[model samples]
Target chain A: MPRWVRHRYASLVVLAVVIALLPLLFPSSYYYRVAALVWVSALAAIGLNILMGKAGQVSLGHAGFFGIGAYAVAIGPTHLGVPPLASLLIGAVLSAALAYLVGRPILRLKGHYLAIATLGLGVLVALVITTEIRWTGGPDGMPVKKLVVFGWRASGADTWYWITAGMLLIGTWLALNLDDTPTGRAFRALHDSEIAARVAGVHVDRFKLQAFVIAAVYASLAGSALALMNGFVNPDQAGFLHSVEMVTMVVLGGLGSVIGSIVGAAVLIMLPQALTVFQEYEHLLLGFLIIVSMIFMRDGIVPMLAKLPGRRA
Target chain B: MSKQSHFKTLFAAAAIALPASMMSFAGTASAQQTVKIGSVLSVTGPASFLGEPEDKTLRMYVDKINAAGGVAGKKLELVIYDDGGDANKARTFATRLVEDDKVVAMVGGSTTGTTMAMIPVFEEAQVPFISLAGAIEVVDPVRKYVFKTPHTDKMACEKIFENLKQRKFTKIAMISGTDGFGASMRAQCVKVAPTYDVQIVAEETYGPRDSDMTAQLTKIKAVPGIQAVVNPGFGQGPAIVTRNYAQLGMSSTPLYQSHGVASKSFIELAGPAAEGVRLPAAALLVGDKLPDNDPQKKVVLDYKKTFEATANQPVSTFGGHAYDGLNILVEAMQRANGADPKKVRDEIEKTKGFVGTGGIVNMSPTDHLGLDLSAFRMLEVKGGDWALLPPGT
Candidate 1:
């Protein structure tokens, strides 16, 4: 606990500062642009980590929540008379509430079953968005309203970077803080052994539902951020491939760690772009990398690296 | 450790802060050179078949224009991001292009779904953009900035029905993808059915990724009065539609597909089933078949030869849209005589007679999408090639 104490808010503050300054360092605006993308994708992965890493549950359809968050933010304000900020909060509440109701039933399922159920949920959301052209703008998607705060519009990338960075720091702090809380202990206990945690008097189902709701809220917020930043929302955010990408980012970085989710999101988002040719070779490289990671670095890159040289395991 | 003491120490001491160190080199660059235009295409995702070639065509046109003393005496710096069929990614890149890179204008988004997500960003920034996708919704609820180059599903459907009207194929069955393209095409078909007196005996949809269309085909075949089948714009939907038609022994029943099937690639993919398959297209692909004086003849031949030589891949309608889109954008830039986005957009709207590989694009203030029914030329596959359908059947 003392060891973790040194890196808590300080590390988050540093991360926040870095996000704010990253655009300045870029040779061109393109790098800052990709960096901002890293923040959005990282936000999404962090949401999923609550379910996969902390909650002792799995979800493949979290993107559905993300998409809902995005669409609601864009459409809610433009046509529904809700302001952009209000729509963003509404999206989070709706996604979290829906996650609570759905998680109560499906959280009982294990492994692949849980994943597939979530997958089905995401597909259903995407299908509805694409099919309901009148309300949701169909597959073509709805135009997003500009996100205005206090009667003033966000000036440019430099200004918005601060807002996103602030949210990311807050999100990270909350997740890390929760890890040290009693509910967090119960969730971790459930992750280690469900039966053992049950015998130890942990309310397994409630904890799972709580984590699911929390993660769904994170995803919804991430979606809102994307919609607000870009001023657009489309059904493709809810598509199955998007769901897969979130998982891939988590798994690629270091699934069980909060830092891993951020790192994973950063790496996963930047890598494919760095390896643009990797598009044709993505399935092959991704498969090989996953297999190798699972076989060798079972605990993921962060933990595995933590175990190496001068570090305590 | 005291919380305040720990925070002070941690904030004071930098422990291998790569992100912060990376951020230390921030510098703003101001330049006066060429106008930059950015685009996001689904170049590597499920829709790569559409995105990849479109990206290629865009690069080709930019190169061609820049080589020819550039547009408005200023070369175009074309920037692109491959969304790989992901909407969120498209949104991200659109913002980057418009905000960070400070592109004067934006053009060439792929898939109606992806392009739809970008409309708000373009509208918010007041960046003029031209989407190459065929969805009517891209232009619908029309944001002043979002424009399109390809004909909408409604126009394509009407043109197809008109061609069928001439062919005297009245009773038809419909096969479609469960995705947006399929749904849009189906809506157009239903709306136009009454005008053509065409009775659609049955309508079937297959999952977007479904490898087989046996069930849908079997149902379509069972329709007693079905004389032909109309397949909407599908990536692999035509192969399934044609294969299942052949399997059901309804090969004699004339099959018409959306312009999506007009490319030579479809013929190769569908094999013998592609023969006699008709679709409306702007490109007169079979050069020898068209008269020498045809406007598109020279453009088509040059592109076909250039693309085959460079990419070693057969051409597609996706490429045609890319060609038309870039040519128009460049023309607009030339007409604007500067990199001003609003000026470029207005000039684009006022464009009258510009020849593209596909057709003559004539943009007007009221219609950002200029190609009407007359712009479409009906083509059918014969011996694994696009054969222009003779006028009046």
Candidate 2:
């Protein structure tokens, strides 16, 4: 068996085991809701990791796609009377198309310039969502219709846990598999040096655009899952801070590790919940903890831990 | 090869450790004798100004209640989670409040967004939740288990328009912030304006973060026969608008701010420009100024005194909303004689003549928020302080 394929299957099995087993320790259904959030966030981070980690691209406005996905489900079900599940797909497709249209020009920029451009894109999306009160419900947000399939309602936290966890597994599997594919190699080549990849006959622009599109789909799917699970969608879901949060998860988890992305999501999501015991000092402690973790794990928690002695690749 | 196995171990250890820690905190054995009331407030984010006082008020009152021999023979245990003004987190915390804390009743949701996000969770859980938000949609469509303490923006608009009608100011201009509160109140005002014999002659909006709104004010000033200018916004935006109105010498056309800026800090921020500015606010803002014959005077004064002394800060209407919500829930619990959610919900629906910090609340089966326009007092800024305006003025 090829090493990459073996590693991919092994990672999937481990993740599946974790997802299946975590519920055993949950004292109540509340953890399921939180776990579902982590899964959705991790899926988005994994997508961002592909762009930031593998392709050496940074997107500060990825939440724009997320918002698009979220609002699509919200508007589609409320306005167009489409099924919630169908709207999720429609959102993904719309996000992919929008990414493609925007990525061609925006991907030409590099570094801070690209970051600023992407930031502007995210702000514009949030602005539209906030201003278009007729459809988007403005800043106060709109309720999402519960997901129903064949008369079965997908409404509780436990059900959403399984749904989001299942999606995250598929997302991680696809991302890990793509890591060693020809297209994935082209992305990595471009990451190493865009000039070198171009001289080596790699389709740099095409690969960059592909990565962007795929990442947008991931964010869109994640956003749809979140909105459906929460049963509400607001403009904040597509705001700049959310975009920064997706990037933070990617960077804090480890730039190139799939498991790292999941861990990062878990840490960021769970830490705030756990820190609620601090009451008014919650944000202060959260900021302090993040700074402490970053200092110890400069390369991110997963990579830093994996590089410790006695670990074998 | 070994790296994968190591990661699996790490993942397992981390997952187990995290939840185990959470369980240790949440799994205390005192669940039987205590009436658990859960809250999810935006206690540490953009809406913290609303949530911080709310958090303080709830804790102070819960402690006081427990000290005074508890409610229905059960000690009150408050379980609060701060959502940082994020809707997603609010939903998650609402689930935790229901399933984990097993709270029979809840009394927090600082912002409209957080309150809306949490509604489905509490509804599904069948727990009675008293929200502290100001959006009209919360109670307009009336869900079974949901109630709110704050006056709706629609009511605020109606009260302001009622005042405007008395002043015979039919032609008005609106300069509102584009934020949630401002936009919502503006829409509500526009919808109900004609009923009050008021017409919005000119409309302008400023972004939430804009330091200056002179442009919008200038446009509003340009409108012909504008009898009054209404600003439906909170925070520094309204203050800037107030200062800008004064700067542009548009004070000849009376400036009416919304309940969104009914606090004393607004007067401090806008300085002398806030003079003669009128808004509809809860009785809590003018506790000292309320008439002795008023039913809300005693309740409002007590809440203001206790909250300010304990929190060591000036009381805000936002905090008063929390006070009203918790007291209303406790009153219902007392009448029902227990903390059973169904019984408490029914009792809350039947609440009558219960004076709170906001006003005299009389909830009913059809009206979740039973306070009418009379609950809001028209107040004007006089000498950098809130001065109650008499009814029909």
Q: Indicate which candidate wins on TM-score.
A: 2
Name every residue pair that clashes in candidate 2.
A313-B1
Candidate 1 collision pairs: A24-B26, A25-B25, A25-B26
Candidate 1 residues lying further than 4 Å off, grouped into runs, are A1-8, A15-37, A74-90, A147-162, A271-298, A301-313, B1-35, B66-68, B72-76, B124-127, B140-145, B167-171, B195-201
lDDT of 1 by residue, B54-81 (tens): 8888887788778988887788888887
Q: What DockQ does each prediction reach against the true complex?
A: 0.35, 0.47
lDDT measured at residue B162 in model 2 versus the true structure, 0 to 100: 89
Count the clashes in each prediction: 3, 1
| Candidate 2 CAPRI grade | acceptable
Question: Residue B280 CA error for candidate 2 (Å)?
Answer: 0.9
TM-score of each: 0.87, 0.96
Top candidate on DockQ is 2
DockQ result, candidate 2: 0.47
Interface RMSD of 2: 3.7
Alpha-carbon RMSD, candidate 1: 4.1
Minimal lDDT window, size 10, model 1 chain B: B8-17
Q: What are the runs in model 2 whose C-alpha is more than 4 Å off?
A: A1-6, A310-313, B1-28
